[model samples]
Structures are given as C-alpha cells and as structure tokens.
Target: VLKDDLVYVADLFIGIQIINVSDPNNPTEFLRFGTTGANPRDLCIYESLLYYSTWYGGISVVNISNTLNPVEICHIWLSDRIEGLFVSYPYLYAANLEYSVSVFNITNPSSTYKMTEFHESVLVFDVFVVSNNIYLAGYAHGLSIMTLDKGGDLQEISQHFFPNHHHSLVIDEPYAYVGDKYSGLHVYNINCVANQRISVSLLKAGGFLALAIVLIKLSLKLLPKILEKLSPYKRGYGL
Candidate 1:
C-alpha cells in the first residue's frame, strides 16, 4: 500500500493475477505469475526486490525489478512458523511463532544467511526495527525490546510483561502502539530507556525507605525502655 507506482497486485489464486490498478475505480488484470503453493500472507517491496513470508514455505525473495517477469531469487528455509517480517538495509527480522525472532543477513538477496537467533518466553508474532533497537509483539510475554549490533547479534534490552497476548506492533516516532489479542490495544512511550530504569530505581528506593521507617519505629519504642534502665539506681545498666 506504500507504493503509488504499484500497477498490479497478484491475487495468487489461480496464479499471480496482476491487476492494473493505475486507476482505483477502473483496475485491470495485466498478468499472472503461477506457482504451486498457497498465496503469500505478507510481503514488502523494496526497489526492484520483493520479499514474502509464507505459512507452509519459508521466506521467499523475488526479483520484481522487471514486474512483467518476476523471478524467484531464493527461498530461505525456516521450520519455525513466521507471522511477520520487517526488512531494513541488509538485515531482515522475522517474527516466529516458536517463541523467538530470527535475524537474517539479506545483503545478498539471492542467498539469505541466518545471522542470529533471539529467544523469549512467549510467541513472537510481529516485529519492527528503529535505528538499532527491535520492538517485538511477544504474545503472552507482552512487549520485548532488543538491541542489534552491526554484526546482527541481538542483546535483549528489556521486556514489559502483560496479562494477555500481544499480536501486532506499530511505532510512530517516540511511541509504540501494540495490539493485544485479549486486552485490546496498548500504548507505550519509547522516548528513552530512562523511564524503565526509573521505575526499577523507585521500587528499590521504596524497599529501602520501608526498612528505614521500620527501624525508626522500633528505635522509638525501645529508646524509652533503654533510658529507664540506664538510671544510676539500676545496677544492670552499668554492666
């Protein structure tokens, strides 16, 4: 839906049915690219390249530079089911149902190389990358944030736990909007990690403050008894 020059969209029913949608009201079928499997679920087009993730099959990279004769460049095998994908620069991040996210080096689109794997407790359904951080919709595990180095190694920055399953995530500037299956949509402010760290510090400070209050109360109650026993007449006070 991002491309305005997109002339056609393959229906993938009988084949890759092309519709000339130059005009929204009067769209025309131009061509078809036939294949032997189910249609693609989600796809992204970058320049002349088209990337798609399937249900039964893995990720498919196609050369759509020439839209008329689109050729299959490669099919990366991933046994773990995929739900969503986001490609940035030379890296591709896939949200897998196997409670993890798979990172691939797609610098050579014809041969996708598995770079690294990041695991979590809940099912990962969708993910998006902004700068070096990857935001994921972790079902049952809530929201997971990870930082990826230049080499594609993932370091789990932090995670926010929710009561329900999260299905989708969308980020706009400094905020992240997540869609939870049972709990509905949730919004998070991602301006900085300071907010997360602040919460942790507050909890620790609260515990320390409680301990101080308890010690002060105990001292207040015991001070009178100690003073009474410390009188010169009380022989036990000297010992």
Candidate 2:
C-alpha cells in the first residue's frame, strides 16, 4: 500500500514494513509492525486504516494514523488463507486461498463484517476490482470475471483460461496482464470478450477465404492435367 512518500510492504515472515521512499536512491525502513503471529500475505490502505491479510487466516485492520505507533483496530477471521486484498470505498474484497473471494462491508472500517462471497472450485491467488467487475486470478483455473449485482450477489460474467497457473494480474482498461508461475507474463485482450460474436464472425470469414484460396490453387494445378487427358489428339486444342 502506497500513501504519499511511504510504502507499506507485506513482508511474509517479518510482517508489514513501512518504508520511506523520500529519497529515491536510498530508501529506509521507517517501522515494521504486525509481526507477532501469522504471515502477512497482502495489504490495502483505506483512509488512515491499513488492512493486511494473513496466510494462516483472516485480516487485521491497523490504525496507521500515527506512523510511529500503529495500533490494531480490528481483526476479522474468515478463510484458511487470504492471499490477496482489494479495497474499493466501503467494501474490501479478499481472495481466499481455499476456493473463494470473500467480500466485506468496511463502511465502518474498524467494525467491519462479511457481506458476501463469490465462490469457485479453483484456488484464488489474487483479486483485482475495477468499476463493478471483480477479476480473480486462480492457481490453475486462469481468470474469472464476475459482476456485483443489485443485491450485492456475485454474478459470473465470463472466464478466460490459460496454460500455467496465474499468480497475479493487473488490468489497464482493455488489456489485462497476468503473471504466470512458469511461463512468466501473459497479456490478454479483454475487449474481445465483449465483442465475441464479431470476432467469431471474422474468424469464420477468414477460414472460408483461406479454404477458397486453397481450392483455387488446386484447380489451377489440376485443370492442365485434366485437359491433357481429355484432348489426347491435340495438345493445344484451345478448348
């Protein structure tokens, strides 16, 4: 989580580290807190409170109002492991390692509660939210796109599959860049999903054009041989 010149890092074993990047060349660690128990997997900052997810289970909200002495305001325990976190205004989305993305009502910040969850069979590694859509990065299931309905229920929009396991993802408008475990990085054109019918039509047209070209070439090669056999008397019959 980035706030002004300070960057809060979720150090797995060492807890969350508050680093001061006032100097670009040489940055120093200001403070490291929340190192008591479970490993911090991910962290998100909303207002003055910082929410950090733990690997063992649940998330802890810390009061970062005083950078020198941070205080733990609230702790909410949920899934087996919280891999990633994303906060959008009053709601906080957590990617559970078990199989789902849990949503929390963080309107009160300190007194937050679970609102809803989008469940799936795949292992959710990370989550990214944009507008009303929530994108989930899975271990072997690739990516899952879902939308928040009027009743706050999660509705599946579509799913895109890839080869290796997806560790993380970042969406920039029409494109999504996914980080794979083995194959490095993968870039996907998400805009095509909206125009799927048009894309399929274009692909079908291209296939037909390619087939026509192949048939024309074969006819050009075979016509001479057919003519040679038909007009045995004259080689240049003009027929």
Candidate 3:
C-alpha cells in the first residue's frame, strides 16, 4: 500500500511493515503490524483497509486507518490456498490456486458472503477488474476478458494467448502488462477499437494463408503430369 510518503509492505510470516520514505535517499522502517495469515500470497489496499489472500490460509481484512497499530478486523477461512486479490467497491476477487476465482460480497465486512466462484476447471492464476470487465490470466488459456451476467455467470468477451502460459497481469488503462512463466513479461494494448481491427486483420491474413497453402498443394499434385507432357520423353516410360 502506498500512502503519500509511506510504503506498506507485507513480508508473509514477518507481517506488514510501514516504511517512511519522506526522503527517497534515506528510507526507514516506521512501524510493523503482525498478520494472522499463515503465508500471505498477495494483498490489496482500498481506502484505509488492507485485505490479504494467503496461501492455504484464506482471506484476512485489516483496518489500516491507523497504520502504526493496524487491527485485524476479520478473517475468512476457505480451507484452500489463494494467490491473488482485487477489491472492487463491495466485492473481493480471490484468485485461487486451483481452477476458480472466488467472489465474495464484502458490503458488510463483518458478514461477508461467498457470492460465487468462476472459471471453474480452468487454472485461474490471477484476476483484475476494470468497472464490470474482469481480466483473468490462466495457466494454459493465457489472458481472457470476461464480464458477469445478471445471474453472475461469466461471459467471455475476448482472449489472447500468451505463447506458453500466462501467470499474471496488471492493467493500466489502455495497456495490460502480462507475465508468462515461459516467456517473461509482455505489454499488450487492449480495450480499444484498434485491437478489434487487428483481430479482424489477423483473421483475414490466416484465411489467405490457408488458401495459398491449398493452391500450392493442388499445383504440386498436377506437377508430375505437366512435367511428363512438357518433356519430349512423354511415352518413354511410366512417366
């Protein structure tokens, strides 16, 4: 969490710490607050609250209104591991280690509900939401953009294959910084009319290439007969 001149970082078992960087050259640790999560995988800070998704520990919400002495407001146990987190208004998106991204309604922090789980049977590694659009990065499926319907079912809008496997992604407006386990980091310009045009062009190019290959094969098949007819030794042998 970035708060003006202070930077809050979580060191998993070591808990969360506040670092004072009023002067960038000389930084100092200001405060340290303990965490209840066994192994904090990832966390997100919205407003004055800090939410963490832990490995094999579930989710924990902390009140960081007072960073020096932060309070653990609540902890929800899912009995499974969580890798990524994104807090949007009244909801918390928990990217599970398995194949689902669990959605939790956090309107009433004290009484949170497990709303739904999406991308089931797919290796969903990370997820981020922009307005109503949710960007999911899967192990094999790469990056997929989706939105939830009225009944909370996922509807895929568009997708991009990240070569081998997509591990994570971070979006900033028109650009998305994606990470692949085999290919490293990549920058993709998404959510624009230009991208749609590129998609159409790629489709057209693929169709043309397929047609060219078919024509080449047909020419090759008739090449032997044409060669025999063109040559003066046409009836010399089985040619």
Candidate 4:
C-alpha cells in the first residue's frame, strides 16, 4: 500500500490485484491482471510503473499511471523462480529461490533487461534495497545485510539469525521490522553505527582535503612577504 489510496496485492497463483482501499470496510476491486507466469511472488510500485516478480516468468512491468486500468508495458524473462522484487529507480532487483539474485536495468522501462545475476549460498526469500544498502530475508540464512558495490555486485556485510523462519523485511530509518512465519512481526533496531563507518571515513578524508587546500593557500599568500624580507640577502644588502 502506497500514497495513492491504492492497494497492490501479489495474488500468489493468480496474479496481481489492485484494489482501492479508500474505504477500509468495503474495499473495491479496481482491477486484476495476470502475469506471464502463474505465480506472482512480489509486487513493487514506483511512480507510475508496477513491477511484478512472476516466478519462472522473470519480471513483468505494467503502467499503472491510470489506476483504473493498468496496461502491460514490458516483460523480462529469467527462467528462474523470482521470489521477491525491489525497485530502486534505474534498477529492479529480483530475489530468486534457486538461481539466486537477479538485477535488471530499468532506466528505460520500455527496454528493461537483465543486467546481472549472481548466486549466494544463502536462501533468498526476499530482498530490499535503499541506495547502496540491501536487506535480504533468508529462510535458512536468517537476515542478511548486503551492500551493492560500485560494480553493482552484492556483498554481504552482516547477518543475524533469529529463532524463526524469516520471510520478509521492511526498514524504517533506525529500525527494521522482520516478518517471520514462526515469530510473526519481529522488531529489531538496525545497528547503523557500523554502516556509518564508511560515511565517517569519507567525511574525515573530505575534511583533510579541505585543510590541505587552506594551508596551501596560506603558504602562497605568505610566500611574497617572506621573499620581501629575504630580498636584501639575495641582493647583498648593506654591503
């Protein structure tokens, strides 16, 4: 559920269903559409586009700009079972159970294609990414915090194991909420202190660079005065 009084539900074996939840009691079925494959694992919406991770069907993109009628826009086939999806602008990430994680370049919606696919040892149940940081809810691997390297490859930072089967995760600033089949909604305060190390180092490096520039400028300014003071030495003054 997002801002536009709309509800997008990934209807497992059926497909993607859109409902207008403005009225909580009597929600209206706005529209229902099927994907290329039978199972619609996850739904992610960005602006006017709706991204659907259809298991074995790759990813299906629909133009939901018109809420009343969502038209199929594009499809990218991966042949692997896509368990979850996360849309971060120019990129659409798909979490696969068997083939692992797949990344798609969706900078141009019309020409969306698979950018890269990599397999990690962990069981990928769901994936969420904000900026360079990625969060994955693993069935056996528990909760994994991964980061997207500059080369767009996922690198695991840390992982925590809960006493339940982890299903999905949602992040809210300083805290992260995990959905587990055994434990229900598990709330854990995200330890961002470790994540901030890189940022802190970058800030320190920036400050050093600024200080160097300032010192260089001061030296340049004082050089003229020093030369003026030593001018007599150079010209054999008082000789």
Candidate 5:
C-alpha cells in the first residue's frame, strides 16, 4: 500500500517491509516488521492502521502511525487461507483459496465479525470493491460481479466466464481490467448493456507478473457520478 513516499509491502518471507520510494529511481528499504503466526499474503491501509492477511488464514491489524516502531493492534483468524484483501473503511473483504470470498465488519477491531461469505465452487484469488459492486477473480470461472446490500449480503449481479485463469481484478469507470494467468490482461466495458470485452495482449513480450490500475485525481472525482448511473440497483445492467 502506498502512503505518501513510503510503500508498505506484505512480504511472504519477511512480513511487512516499508520502502521509501521518494526517489523513484533508487528505492530503499525503510524498515521491516516481522509477523509471527504465518507469512503475509496481502496488505491494506486505512487511516492509521495497516491490515495484512496471512497464509495460515488470518488477518492482522497494525498501528502504523509511527513507521519506525509499528505495533500489532489485533489479529483474527478465519476458516480458509486468504489471498487478497480489500479494505473499504469499516468493511474488509477477503478472497480465499477455498471457494469463498468473506466479508468482515471492521467497525470495531476487537469485536470484528464475519458479515457474510459469498461461497462459489471455485477458487477466489482476489476481491476488489467499486461502489457497491464486488469484483472477484474466480480462477478458471472468470470474473464474478456481486453487490453488497444494506443487510451486508452479497447478491450476484452478473458473471463473465472466460477460458483464461482470472487471478486479479480492478475496475476503472467504464471498464473492468482482469489479470489472467495464461493470457496477459483482459479489459471489459462494464458500462455497456452487453459488456463488450476489449482484450489487450501483453503476454507477447513475457509473463504478466503484476497489475496496477492508478486513477488520477480527475478520474477519482468523476467516479461517483459515473458509478451512480451504473449502479447495481438497475435491472439488466451488465458489469
């Protein structure tokens, strides 16, 4: 997670490592915070806290107000191993290797509880939230779109099945970008009625190792209005 000039990484081998990226050309390691139970899988930041997932199927919250000396605030374990973690304020969404995407209400870290689990008979590698829609990378099952209702339930909105293995997903306005294991990247027009996909092949050069979608300030400002028009409440809307 990027915070100012520092980037906090949830390293599988070394736990949370802080890197100073103020100098884009030559980045240096700022500090390292070791985690006990299991190796870290993913990281998410909100306010002064940093949330990280573990390979042993657990989540840990750390107080990162002081980068030099970070403290572990709380840690919670789940049933299945978590791969991807996305934090939207009070809600924390986790993608598990064992056929499910779990949602947790993080309003109170000490009293945090699993709100709901969207169980699908497929491996879910990543979970990303845009407005009320939950975009999931369901391995070979492709991208699954669901909506988070007021009752904290995840209801299916749409599904896009592809042959490529969907490993990660991110949405930017009119399009949804999906990272495939075999075939580089896949882009779909979520604004359209049929949701037209515009595949951009990046595997020609080499492997598609990482995917990052950065939204500029202007794009971020326009997102609220755009998402309102494409809200999941509308029937027959394809996303």
Candidate 6:
C-alpha cells in the first residue's frame, strides 16, 4: 500500500488492481481487470502504462491513463511460468520460473518482440532495473547483475550468492535491499567500487587469513638487517 504518489499492486485471486491514493486513508479502487490466470504476483507502473506478471499468466500490459477505466493493452505469452516483471524506457524484463530471464522490446507496447533470453539452473524470482543495469534474484542462484550491450543484447556483469533462497530485490539509490527466504531482509551498501571488493573480501576471508599468516611467516624468514630496515624504527622497539 504505497501512498506517496500513486498506488499499484497485484491483487491475487482478484486481478491487477490500481487505486487512487491521493487521499491516502480514503483510497478508491479505480481499476480492476481479471487476468487470464489466478494469481497476479507482481506489477510495476510506468507513466501511463502498467506491467504485470502472474503466477500462471505470462505477462500483461495495461494502459491506465484514465484511472477510472484502465484497459488491457497487450499480453505476451511466456514459455514458462513468470513471477516478476520490470519495465525500463523501451524495454521490459521478466523473471521466469523456467530458470531464465527474458527481455522484450516494448517500444511499441501493442506489438512487443523478444530481445534475448539467459538460461540458469535456478528459478529467477524477481528483477529490477537501475539505469541500464538489471538486477535479478534467483531462488538458488542468489543475485545476478546484467547490462544491455550496445546492440541491445543481454550481458552478464556479475553474480553472487547468499546463504538463503533469494526471493526479491529492490535497488534504491546506492543501496540494494534483498529479501532472502531464510535470512529475512538483507541490506547492502552499493556506494563504491570498494563495495564489490568488500564483498569479495568477505567471501574469501578464510583464504585471506591464511595468506596473511603465510606472509607473516615469509616476513619472519627475512634476514635481521632486512627486518630492521622494514621496521618503523632502527633498533628502537616500541614498548
């Protein structure tokens, strides 16, 4: 029930519903449309359009310029079950349970065309776009970050795994909020390139510790004169 600007939500068992939330407490259910399937899992609203992915139905696009009378504009059939969807500029991306992520060109909303697909072993549960990058959450694969190539092709940038099953992810500013089934909610700081380095460091801390110990051993093997020169003070040991 987000009430800042507009309200967009998927009312499972009912349909994709949008409410006029200008009055917050007095939110009016303005649009209701039955989907081809039962559960409307997730949806996103952009400008005058609404994109939804259902548990059974592939994908649905609706025009909500007139809030009172929203119309179904297009529906794209998927090869497998879909759980989440996101729309950015002229593109739409869907997370499919068939262990893959699908991309579509939505320049012409009425006639969308498949752009590309990436296959994985784990189900893709949710996805979100930030700038030109796509962040995907997989049931077993954790997080996958991808970008669009100059030719509009999908390219994998990086992927990392957490301990629990990844369910959903939301990118806000320089942070990414991940919903892990067993871990509850996890917040990540995405402020700098150092963050990626920190993630890597955390992932291999055991090996790093071993390497530090080995380096200390190697340093101890140095000659007395070399050790003295490497020390902060020449023959003046700190108390």
Best by TM-score: 5
Task: Tell me the spans in candidate 5 whose CA falls farther than 4 Å from its real position.
Answer: 193-205, 208-239
Clashes of 3: 0
Model 3 residue runs over 4 Å out of place are 192-239
Question: Could you give candidate 6's per-residue lDDT for residues 164-194 as a string of tens digits?
Answer: 4666665664655555554444455555422
Per residue, candidate 1 scores C-alpha lDDT tens digits across 1-239 of 22343533424355444566678788776667754346544455556676666656678887876777889988887666776677776788888888889888888888887889988888887887777888888767767788897665898888877665666655554666555544434567776654553121111113334434433443344445322322000000000
Candidate 4 per-residue lDDT over residues 40-144, each given as its tens digit? 777777778888877677788889887777888898876777876777767887778883777888988988988777677766777767557677776766666
lDDT of each: 0.62, 0.69, 0.63, 0.63, 0.69, 0.64
Clashes of 6: 0
Count backbone clashes in candidate 2: 0
Clashes of each: 0, 0, 0, 0, 0, 0
Top candidate when judged by lDDT against the true structure? 5
Model 3 clashing residue pairs (backbone): none
User: Model 3: per-residue lDDT, tens digit, 51-86?
Assistant: 876777778888878766788878998777787677
TM-scores across all candidates? 0.71, 0.79, 0.73, 0.75, 0.81, 0.75
- In angstroms, how far off is 141's CA in candidate 5? 1.3
CA shift of 107, model 3, Å: 1.2
Residue 46, model 3: lDDT of 71
lDDT (Cα) of model 6: 0.64
User: Which RMSD does model 5 reach against the true structure?
Assistant: 7.1
User: Cα miss at 127, model 6 (Å)?
Assistant: 0.9
TM-score of candidate 6 on Cα atoms, chains taken together = 0.75
